[model samples]
Target: MVNEPSNSANGGARRPWITTVAILLVVLLAVGAYLKLRPRRIRISVVQPALQAVSSSITTNGKIEPIHSFEAHAPLAVTVKKVLIKEGDRVKAGQLLLVLDDSRARSDLALARTRLKTAQAGYSALLAGGSQQQLLVRQADRQKAITDRDAAQRQLSSLERLQQRGAASPDEVAAARDRFSRAQADLAQLDSQVRYSPQDLARSKAEIADAEANIAVAQETIRNSNIRAPFDGTVYYLPARLGAFVNAGELLLQEADLSQMQVRAFVDEPELGRLAVGETTKITWDALPGRTWQGTVTTVPSTVVNRGSRVVGEVLCKFDNSDRLLLPNLNVSVTIIANSKDNALTVPREAVREDAGHSFLYVLQGNRLHRREIKLGISNLTRVEILSGISQNDIIAVHSFSPAPFSDGVEVKIVENPS
Candidate 1:
């Protein structure tokens, strides 16, 4: 009977330990079963893999700029008094866009008109005979000169004959000789007086013409006070306000033909050979979503490379502006089709991944995912051209719920999409 009750208590303590171990073993088995039944996460997209004619195009970033942009400036200095057009108003060629105070111009024009009139009058006078009094005076002087010359010649002959016969003294002969010489000189001077003095007449005429020209120039300057549109365009900007004083060549407005819109895009050096005049282009704008505008390469920039960095040159594309909505300075993006090939295999762009300067994609066959190395060609934002390593029907996983390291023989299940 020794210590039998204490032995029962020790037995009970051992029983508790055995029960705790059994519960822990059951919990472990339950956890392992839950993990085995858990679902795997996978992302799937509805993809269409096909072979069709695909054009290899180059996409570049660029901005929309007007083909005809110009700054309207005043030809002469004047105070602006009234503006006819606002910032966004369409105007025709020769339409008045603004008007200056023009008092100065008017005065100038009046002066110019006077000059023109004077020039015309002077020109008229030149066409008609010179002054009658002047003509008469010339005729009289010419006649007098002829008479004096005749009398001098007669006197000289008489003196010579008298000296030869010794009827006239030597002194008398010399005196007659002097008188004849003096008469000849007077006749020559009279002859000169009869003709017009070229210098004097020319000076007077030139003075009159100059005065007339000044007045005419003033008139033309006044006419220019009314600033007119050079072409049919919209007044895009007007810097001068009414009653504002402006100087010659000051900015009046910036006008551009909204109807004449174009796209200018730059390319990298390596792609220089791909662009040429008459090549087709596809234009897209963030402002106009989902719509692609057709354009043509109208001008290939002559600048082949950057002078400093030797980068590629810019190319210009012209599209018909029929909609009349395209404006200057609107941003745009362009795609240049370098080549086109029929039945080229292409896949979604997101399917490709980069590794060590090579492109690759995960191909799904049955339940296995295989990493397929690929060579790429041209690519748009939505699709990429597949040059090699993938067939038309091969299923390429575009997205995954979790990206983890996978062995070669790893199996994956594609998640179903909601109907």
Candidate 2:
């Protein structure tokens, strides 16, 4: 009994040691696992949401064109005889710019005049009673007819007297009366031929008028041989060369009043909907580096077209070019301000992301990151407007270079924090 009590006491002591050792082992294991499983720090760049003005704009390529321009063309085929102005010469309205050889035009005018004169002469003769020779001939014919008729009447009377005296037959008296009647009819026919009928007079007058119209056209052509400036402008282009034969309606020169210029902005089709008339625009030219010009959207494109490799809509913009430094047909760049908001929460566009068609971003909370779904209002190429999710002071990941990339509950270290 004594030995059993001693053994029980010893066993109880031993049980306490075993329990304490097992607890220590469990603690050590737990500590090792925790050290192994702890999240690693990732190097990344972060930025906080800011409160500033945000704008939604469209930037695209454009070309400069003259809003006020004119192209001169030859009106007739003629050899250029003189070129009074050179390319890039300043000219005024009604100034003589060129002259064409008028030999052909003059010959044409002479022929037209001759035809007109001849037609008028014939027309005038037809208008007068008749030619003197024709009148004299007609009068002579009438007198002869009168004489013949009188002689016939006298013969008829003698015949009739003879008949009455029983020395002529009744048939002879009838023949004498018929001869007198025939002589009177011939005189009447000759008189009718001497006068002009209304139809004949109308035909002659129309011929004369048609000839005169031709003369007028020829005269106008001769006048047009001299090319004159229709407006005050700079002759930027002059294709008129001395002794060069040019056809009618051929381009002679081009001019424009360079007081103002236009820029044709070609916005991508996807970005075209944001364009509106009267919108403020900024323009730049590659040739003139570090310079910008201001303008307004004067015209919005009604349709889209394919230009080069892009599908774009051409928007017209007008600007003040009073200095005349900007030439026509120069390529330029255009930036159109579509929408803007002031005192709004804004963030870098690079920080904002999309998840399943929903706007999202990785926001830093303490040492860990949390995926946040956000709502946006307006955005430009560089910055975006954050509407609902992020606060002004919240830090969001802009870029990451660590092997362990961004994810929920992942620890991160900010290599750069640009507030």
Candidate 3:
């Protein structure tokens, strides 16, 4: 009887332990089923569109140049004799800048003058029949011929009268007549030699014209040897030194009126369409840091060219450089304000997505993402101007933390509100 009571006590203790274990198992199974069937929510960051001022600009590298500049080059191969002005000297119009060794030029001018004088003398001789010596010789020859002809004519007349009276033979009279005819022919030839033909006069005139042209050329060369400044400017470059020899067309000096300056900005070909005339430009140079100059775009590129490995267009800009601090051939940084607007609707560039030539944004509606097509306007590096399709009050999803792609009706968990 004692052993049966102990067995019943142990069975009662084991039954309570089994019921507690069954209840724990049922609770765990219900929790797992609930967790597996629950909906998933992707974690995302959201922002609302804002209204602010935005500007679209293009930053590029540019080169500074003078608006009104002059470069002097050697007119011919010559030695630099005198350098009157040094580099960085301010000069006036018609000022003598340098002098070249003009010995050869002067010699050439003298030779040309002598040739002109000779040509003039020859032309004068042609107009006046012949030279003085030739005229005198011809005159003497003509007088001798006239005297011979008169004597011969008298002889022929006497011979004819004598022949009629039988004092002179017929053969003698014929010989006297032949002598008179020969004298007349000799006189005619001498007169022809003293007179100039029309062709001769024309040819003489042509020679004079040629000589005059040579004189003009020689005079011009002499003037060029004396280098002079054609306009008022500053001499920024001087390559001609005293006694240095230079060849034709070699650069001697460069000058400019540093009151105005021009900049040629090289812009990438893709951003060329955004450039326009009259746009505001800001310039900065590494040599003069912290100083910025304002300018205007005077012209846009007409063609595209290759710059290094990039295709770019050259944009021209003009600015007032009255202080003369900016110089020519300086490389500078250029920023052109292509477009600007006040109080325009803007959103972070990350919020917008493009697909198949269409731009859209994912709007957060009641914790779900909705794809809405939006129109975009001017954009910069960080933000873009929203032209249409979403109001500033609507919350938009920039990106999701999960790997799942965002689609319409996708539930989202707001991880952080950036805006």
**Candidate of highest lDDT:** 3
Give the lowest summed-lDDT range of ten residues in model 2.
126-135
Clashes of 1: 12
Residue-level lDDT for 199 in candidate 3 = 86
How would you encode candidate 1's per-residue C-alpha lDDT over 61-158 as one tens digit per residue? 66677787767677677788888989998889889888877677667656666666666655554444346666587678778777877887787789
C-alpha lDDT of residue 79 in model 2: 86
TM-scores for every candidate against the unseen true structure: 0.60, 0.69, 0.76
- Best-to-worst order by TM-score is 3, 2, 1
* Candidate 3, 1-419: lDDT as tens digits: 87999999999999989999999999999999999777678889888999999999999999999888888888789999999999889999999999888888788888888988998999898777689997788778789999998998999999999999999987899899999999889878876773788889888888888888888887887898888888898999998899999998999999998888999999999999899999999999898899999999999999999999999999999998888888899899999999999899999999999999999999998989999999999899999999999998999998788878788898999886534
Instruction: Identify the runs in model 3 with alpha carbons over 4 angstroms from their true place.
Output: 1-26, 29-33, 40-43, 135-210, 401-405, 411-419
- Assess the local accuracy of residue 132 in candidate 1 as a C-alpha lDDT between 0 and 100: 62
Number of the top candidate by TM-score?
3
TM-score of 1: 0.60
Q: Mind sharing the TM-score for model 3?
A: 0.76
